[model samples]
Target: MRERVDKLKEEVCTLFTPSKDMLRRMYLVDEIVHLGIDHLFEKEIETALKDIHESEFASSNLYEVALRFRLLRERGFWVSPDVFQKFKGDDGNFLNELADDPRGLLSLYNAAHLFIHGELELEETISFARNHLESMIRDSVVKGPLADQVKRALRLPLPRTLKRVEMLHYMFEYDQDNGHNPVLLELAKMDFNLLQQVHLKELKEISSAILDDTYDVYAFSSIDECRTLNAAIQGWDDTAISLVPEYLRKFYEIMLSTFREFEDQMPSNKRYLVAFNKAEAAEWPHRNYKPSFSEQVALATETTGVRSLAAGVMLGMSDAATTREAFEWAVTSTDAIISCAKIGRFMNDISGYKVTVDVAIAKINELMEDEWKTTNRARIDNQAVIPVTQRLINLTMAIPLFYGYDSDGFTFGEQLREILENLYVKPMPI
Candidate 1:
């Protein structure tokens, strides 16, 4: 599998005119990312994007300018919104003629959303592009991949939708078009479904464990406030903003309640994770004034949602003592816990931190392997525990996202329950 992946990646990198053809390379970067296979060619993708940013678009076409700005800013690179200046008229709005071009309008619409705190031009561009694109959808005589892409992106903007989910969506569109690369499309389909089943399997276990243990109802009241919590983090205001400090305080209270559960199962000294709670408690809001990538992930992991789930894992498993020790391993900021928390931060991006789940799970598997060698447990029980815990860490961060974001695949709470039962409990009729 690794060899096949490497060969495919080499072929993919060769397909790009990385240095000279800025537009084509950028488009390839976007497609590769959307296909959910960019991790296989991270350096190549990063280099291409960086070169495009430095060369900075050979064309002044709206799609070129918009795509360049959107891609760069979305990835956390420093790019100026002033680059959109040339696209505007003397009257200080996006060129009136550009509105007639559906593709350009769509590109601008996407670029507008990447604006952080305050950028008046990008803010205005969003309104202008949205109106034009909506009209394109309503009018007659124009319909194809270009128009369809606009419609889907309008319906579910880039920032809000998950990358993997979006890629799955794009695959359907790609399948219909003769323009898409056939070999790459076949490879992408294989990679996507393989990962999809892995995610579904983990999600099934997560939903089942949530049901068996009865943790769903407890988090319901906090859902609304947590949603507001996410909103405020984005610089948006809500009445629930008042609940921010209180909600943060109450988070530790929940952690303490879960920690108390470890008393019966864990050693007396290990039962109190005062330092863990204290370390997390100090960073109430994960993103501070000028937050870095590393800083944000560190703070996110400390959220009551992630930490509480670590506590719940101890209670959920059959071997209480071993689970408690594993929980302790997680709470102490082990590689497993930190990596898992980092991924949780991007739960919204769908493409964000998702790659990390496989990384974090791999680390936990390593830890489990080390323990397997040291302990004298029965082979059957030890094997069972590793897979279960691997899935647990994979989905732990995801569970917190239900309140703030929607899942394209699972859709609703009842749908989640049904999926778990169908995928794991009942067999498909052959």
Candidate 2:
């Protein structure tokens, strides 16, 4: 019997290792119904149970194995009532007891069964798993081989506790079908250090990729589109505006169309109604400009303004006058930077010595020096715009050599590249 059990264990391990494809296939509903029923007829339930017990199963893969066993029983494979009673009872209180058990492996397996079989609702399944996982994590029993198994079963990175928290947050925030406040509360208790590190690492990789691909496009097109539209509206050069790039022109047209659709869906007296009406007229000058263009531009401007103001407030720059000035400056500066990039001119045209490219560079340098001090400084939650503003400021400072302002003879692109290297590319000390 011992020799047979060892052989069976080896087979099961071999079947499951390196990948789960074979296990998933064998445990699927149709396969279980067919083979499990035949196995019951050929080998008694006691023999099967003995096989499982002697396997010395790894806890992580136990969930998958237990699920297979449950399917077998459900498919009319006979098992004594006593075996069923060991895990569940007539009252359904067995799950709660199992959840509280010091040995969480079995509980996790049972929870997986309830989850996969839809015996419990999605929220209930997630909650049960989270609670049990948290208990195991807090008990600190989830280490060594057990931890490896848990990580494998959960299909997440190690330090299972933090993964649980992030999963809970994702479920609560985005999984409309499984949102549960209690699970969120439980998640909040986890160590945020691990979570933040993981999140920031992911964001850094994504941001780097985006910057690499979109920096030139975003910088150039945003200016060209806005300037063409602005110039057309101001009646500066109708023929030049007509020469706008087809793709960008189409984007403006689509923006106008979508804005109109959105406005049409709104109720009367909504604040957006006023902007929508104005935007409709703004689109007329472009070949494809429609009445809705004004509405879309208005909407975009308002959204940008609100975000900028919120960012200012979050940064503790909430003085109403200062915040308003900063937001206005951000909008104008953003437009100007884009315009210059499109015209292929740098800071040569920008006025005001105090706020010039040189001053911006000095500010970035000062901020870099005091980056440590700003570690605990006020932060804006609207991360997208804050960094964009920082980049805009930096780019503004780096490009457009002032006429007598050093005349170092470095081309605009070269200067901008140097600035990006210094401000963004260099790795910060960890």
Candidate 3:
């Protein structure tokens, strides 16, 4: 039974040997540090080090060499806490001397470690990262202890890629502030190329996240921030904007569509209605009300109503009024009728006439022809007089075509057709 247990243990160890070898070769000690394994299994690390030194495969010197290299590359120092009783020595200037050498690789490595480990905040780290990045960009070579360290840091997921992109964008803004337009342009090109390689979906999500974070900032931020964003978007290609999520595009379209609908429903003379019912029914609250003859005459006099009527005629509502003069007259007459109805409603409130149809008609006509002599002759003839007379005649002729309702002078069919024809026009083909 003991032999079987030993065999099982040996098989498990062999199975994990390849992974352990890879971890050692990759110098994944930093990864283990990030995982907090040092604190969790301190004894295990010590036992491993002891075994490495004892084994023929690894000499005592080999363990010390490996430890020295890791410390030099990652920590920017070769002092082993076990061996160095006092790394600083009696002279505090030793550390200062280490940093003074321009060609010193240890100094660069130390600076990078300080920057990546959050020993420096955003502002400080940005400067540090920028210096190292600039050095690489200018010379394409990193020398000294810091060279391999900085290169490895860049390859590692130390600073998130998205945050790095944001930092670059911020640098462009800084360049703009300093009037360094050429550098700003180069930075923009670099950022664009980097962003283009990112997955389209990821780019959209990241942009949206950025927008959301800046929403309130843009709304209340200095005008410069808003201007900068606008400029950035303008500088970008339309293809980049096209990559925005479809749902957001749809949202903008719906808003524009709503604006157009309100514009259509509003009376031209009045300030457009601020509120409109969106219900899609053709009855009651949603239904358009047809004005009576008196109401029509009143509308023609209201400035906004008159303008709206003119627009309606231009839209081809008047079949008989082909000429421009006739069309203008038709619109003016329609405006006057609407005005008359409004006035009638007002008078009813004041004098309490009960506003019967006959009384309303008389009021409308009285207002229409009251200044007949002073009216523009050509305008009155083509617009007001002719259009009204023709419309009335058309209604009279259509009486036989319609059935039911003979209480009024005009038949129901004639009245209904006149109202329907005025309010609705067939949609134009796309």
lDDT of each: 0.55, 0.35, 0.33
Clashes of each: 1, 7, 24
Best by TM-score: 1
Clashing pairs in 1: 162-350
Question: Compared with the true structure, what per-residue lDDT tens digits does model 3 show for residues 202-269?
Answer: 54553211232132233243334433433333333344334334434443344344435444444464
| Ranking 2 against 3 by lDDT, winner | 2
Per-residue lDDT for 1-430 in model 1, tens only? 4456556666786876546878888788777777667756666766787787778465788888888877776554567788888988787877778867887788888877666544667667777888888887888424876777777777655644456445655776777777787656766765655555676777756422111111122234444544444333333224334545563534433433444555454444543243333333333343343556556445455543444455555554446345544555544544444445444444433422244466764664344333222221111123324423443443432433342233523344574466445434443221
For lDDT, candidate 1 versus 3, the one ahead is 1
Model 1 poorest 10 in a row by lDDT: 207-216
Q: How do the residues 268-333 of candidate 2 rate in per-residue lDDT, one tens digit apiece?
A: 344243233333333344446444633543343342223222222324332432444445444342
lDDT of 1: 0.55
What's the best-to-worst order under TM-score? 1, 2, 3
Superposition error at 411 for model 2 (Å): 30
Model 2's C-alpha root-mean-square deviation from the true structure amounts to 23.4
Collision pairs in model 2: 279-294, 279-295, 280-291, 280-292, 280-295, 346-400, 347-400
Show where candidate 1 strays beyond 4 Å.
1-6, 16-18, 140-142, 200-430
